[model samples]
Target: MLDNPQLTQTVEQLTAVIRLTVPVSEISHVMGPAIAEIMAAIANQGVDIIGPCFSYHYKRPSEIFDFEVGFPISRAITSIGRVKNSNLPVVKVARTIYHGGYDGLAKAWGEFCAWIETKSLNPQESLWECYLVGPESGPDASKWQTELNRPLND
Candidate 1:
């Protein structure tokens, strides 16, 4: 939904973050609620289809192999003693939209793969998720907007 190359940096950053990962099947069942809470707190408060998404780098090793479903953000923060989805210093990324359901995220990642290869770009060591919806709007996959991004490292 956004296209601003200057927003991403040319250099990669090395930082630690608290990331929550889930399978495609669990997105609506799990992350849906969690994201709703966060989205409600943000402006617009609407779930934007931001598009098919996949992670090339995790916020941390712990998050990489985690199945912390049904865990509220507060509980996860309390248990881990940190926030999982906050922004940290990261390398700039070339962002895009891969319109489709959660299952199509793989194809979105493929687009990033293509960008990296075709543009001769390297990962900057950081990525991000921007939710354009929240509980106010309710769960409607068609209205779900997710921004699939790839940080390019120089």
Candidate 2:
């Protein structure tokens, strides 16, 4: 379930990311390796990971998922392989937290968008998910938390 969403402003954040455009079915397959690659690259540069990992999607997912998987970093790093310097843009967004397993994300997003529509908010083409706690935390899926942000044009 998602917490009540609120409007807020986000500061631009520096990040290290690997961009990918793959079939929707391939998201689960690609996510793990992409996250691993990002973490490895960040470690190679001795950069401090300042925040939890996140996926910045360029558009709502359909047949294709085009997005960046990475972590917020203290400073920028030179590009290495697929890992590159990127920034989470500053924008106004309607944000909420979802507490559950990753498998419930699609449903969570549907609910979130429905709320946005009820408020007559104009959302951008993009959105993002910040993974606060997941598999690494424990075996309990009920305790997992993900922060969901949908950029708004208003």
- lDDT tens digits by residue: candidate 1, 1-154: 2222333443332221234565545545655554444434322322232222223335321314342212112211222233233323445667765444455555555666566677767765455544344323565555555565566665
Model 2 lDDT, full chain set: 0.95
- The TM-score, computed over Cα atoms with residue i paired to residue i, of candidate 2 is 0.98
Candidate with maximal TM-score: 2
Candidate 2, residues 88-132, lDDT tens digits: the string is 999999999999999999999999999999999999999999999
TM-score of each: 0.49, 0.98
Query: So what's the TM-score on candidate 1?
Result: 0.49
- Residue 95 accuracy (lDDT) in model 2: 100
